[model samples]
Target: MPSQEALSAQVGAVYTTSTGAPVAEPYAAQRVGLTGPLLLQDFHHIDLLAHFDRERIPERVVHAKGSGAHGVIKVTHDITDLTVASLFSKVGNEAPLTIRFSTVGGESGSADTARDPRGFAIKIKTDEGNLDWVFNNTPVFFIRDPAKFPHFIHTQKRDPQTHLKDADMFWDYLSQNPESIHQVMILFSDRGTPDGYYMHGYSGHTFKFVNKDGKFHYVQIHLRREGGAKSLDNDTAQRLAGENPDYATEQLFTEIEAGKFPTWNVFVQTMTAEQAESFRYNILDLTKVWPHKEFPLRPVGQIILNKNVQNYFAEIEQAAFSPSHLVPGIEPSADPVLQSRLFSYPDTHRHRLGVNYGQLPVNAPLAPVSNFQRDGAMAFNNQGFRPNYQSSLAPLQYKRKAYEDVKHEIWLGDANVDLSYVTELDFEQPRALYEKVFSDTDREHLIYNLSVHLGNVKSPIVKARQLSVFAAVSKDLGDRLAKAINHPSVEPLAVKPATEAIRYKLKAA
Candidate 1:
């Protein structure tokens, strides 16, 4: 290896301080004498140490470990009849894009092959502005109520006292909230571990596509892999998790680097206002999915990830996405989960990145940005000399347009607020999934997967409650799970250990 000075000279790169002052000898600290104490006024030495101390920012609460790549989204079909979003205005219309896929529940260094839902976030740089589609691999979510989100997440994470995953914590939340069954079913299925980043699909609750005529359609966006979706079995997923924790993460980068880019064929399922009114299930319910038979998907566009990022920290780590980052013609629906995210996404970005996170090159809109806001942490460009406020002296140009009436919803029954009702309706869809959607083999795996985790739940009451929830989905499923875990009925009695209960039951039989 060449010496620092020799390397810098050879590369023709000048050594400079963080603020761009010339530094002839950054390797050596200023000294009082040849063998005396070092001087404190060495700005370069102090700066280097200071920057190192603050090098790490806080990891995201979820979807922390991720990989991203540069890409393009090309409109493939006419969607102008549904949406005015310029990103899909014409058949040949194209936009520069960046996509980051991640696992949902793990910390920054967790295994990429963990059996968890994958995040499918994309940022499109359109002439109008930046539009971020922050979605997850699964169409439906675990819980629709925003109030249960933090509690549910805590259960999925390590227990506060033990600093280890608690099975009771996981099952208690789900059992108490039956609405989670639909998503829980999906999570435990083989689909939990996709073959690769692009092997699954995405949805951010349901949204709406409004045309120029103010005609609107409640829509669900699905990005299907060019090839049909595929998944890993439990044994295979666990094996990969141990052998190469960064398996999926590395595969994405390696493929893109080798010029073997991946693409997803985009599609949308639309519902008119009248259809929404008479729909079989509430369109706002994130716990349920719109059946394909009811509303078939329409081909719309394509997402092609062609280029890999040169710097992960600058492009991938610093990339911020929010469900609220919507362009005109694309708007959020009344889905409770989506409603909560519109605020929480941007708020987390402010905390994780900075107040001016949008200004970052990876996140900044392709369209020229001129706003009244100025002066916050990491303010790269302060809009230079122009008025920071709405001034009579020199007001900024405005492009005022009529607000889309299609985006508006008239609330019925009450105005203040209402508690989300939990009813038998929630179980209808999960039951259908178990009875109709999953094959016999798939059902066996689902039950086995649930048993593996539920068996670890120590509390009899919690375990019983969970089995009851499973039974609500299907009587046979519940009976099978109860036998699998050997969990005693929810009667007033001593709660035996799982293995002991199984042995005792067998002996009694």
Candidate 2:
């Protein structure tokens, strides 16, 4: 390890202005007299204060509380046949990568142990370009409709008038959009409060992998930790939320610094377009998962977090990842929520980090950038002396297409404004999860967690509606939740059928 003095010398031993001009007396400000008011001409003193005032850029709206590390992604298997992404061109191939683990729907000061979905975003700097897999700890999400996202996130935030986390606000949204029941059940379970950043990751939205021949396959990415997923009970999680709010972030940094690197095996489940047509669930639905029994995981690579970031703010905080950041062979599926994110993520980055956010050292791609875009806020490298438009004098070379543009012929359908309505199909996975997968102990913990939270909701209507939703999934779960909360049992509501979207279309017409 280098000494502090040596590290300081690498940049500069003496303090200076943002423009690097040496300061004679950084401590003293120019003033009229010994005890007089400080003069505005003291640029050194004024500059220091000014820079400190604007020190922080806007924090992320979602995933604001985060911890990250530098690492390497090494391909462990040959997946060249699946896609032409250079990162998996051959076995043992490696690329520098960064991983950020965060809690969704939380402020920068929010507790790490809060019962919420965790954001597991990874950026792999491959030779072709940067490839980011913005994923979640859960395999599925709450809602599939794109428009429901902002409304859903608002429910997770504090109430405007009350300025507090409102149980009514949360449950009201969930109950109204019963399609969210799958994730709601998962959230009320032990998995909601993960033990630490050491959790399995999944690409909740299905993506596409185009082969060299332009034939594409719908893909779901997974990251399984070397050790299986670990979780905390409701009591332990709540206790930790109060006792150690930064537990997960601190644990990740400390473990990495101590040379105890965490590793996750990367896998992908692929389905051809023909197979997707006959799949049990709509492949583009974010609220569903492709069962492993039908589509098993194929090993691709290993992600090892071997290095802790030197500066959290510079390296990790400024880092941005998006599912839209893809190389040639990787493409996004037409998942509605994902289509919205393809625009939203980069837009958020531009708002938070300026239009030239890509120019930042942390977010910059390794590939040499040659483009017409120039001159925005903080445009340090403006492609100096080059024409902003195409000119015969200074021509730029263009790379040929690696393969033909493969059209998704199977996706051809009547184009219209579509809305996914709640249906029995939406509840199938959560039902299976509760009835088949969860153990007796898991069920007890889940019921206890849900009861404690729901018991706080003051509205009888919200409670009844949510109970009905739960009953639609499993009678045992609904009855247990009602018993735990000392509420009367309610009849299960009939789920809207699959034709509900058509009904919506007819209503609109």
TM-score of each: 0.90, 0.94
RMSD of 1: 7.9
Tens digit of per-residue lDDT, candidate 1, span 1-509: 22345557669677899999998987898888897887789889989999999999889898998888899999999988998888888999999999999998889998888888999999999999999999889988887678889999999899999899888999988887777888898888888888877575667477888888888888999999877778888888888989988888788888877778898999999988888755656677788788888899899989999987866888989999988998888888877678889999889999999999999999989898888889989899788999888898998889743245644444311211332445566677888889998999999988888888899999887888888778777888888878888865332212233233222233346
Candidate 1: deviation at residue 426, Å? Answer: 1.3
Clashes of each: 0, 0
What value of lDDT does candidate 2 attain over all alpha carbons?
A: 0.87
lDDT of each: 0.82, 0.87
Candidate 1 CA-lDDT value: 0.82
- Determine the backbone clash count of candidate 1: 0
Kindly list the per-residue Cα lDDT of model 2 for residues 1-509, writing each as its tens digit.
43355577787467677788988777888898999999988888888899899998899999999999999999999888889887778899999998899998889989999999999999889988899999999999988888989999999999999889999999999999888888998999999999997689999988888788877888999999998899999999999999999999989988887789999999999998889766767777778889999999999989999988777887888998888999988888777788899999999999998899888888888887888999989999899998899989998888865877665633422211354566777888999999999999999999999998999999999999999999999998889899999999977868876455443334346
- State how far residue 104 of model 1 sits from its true place (Å): 1.7
User: Cα lDDT for residue 166, model 1?
Assistant: 87
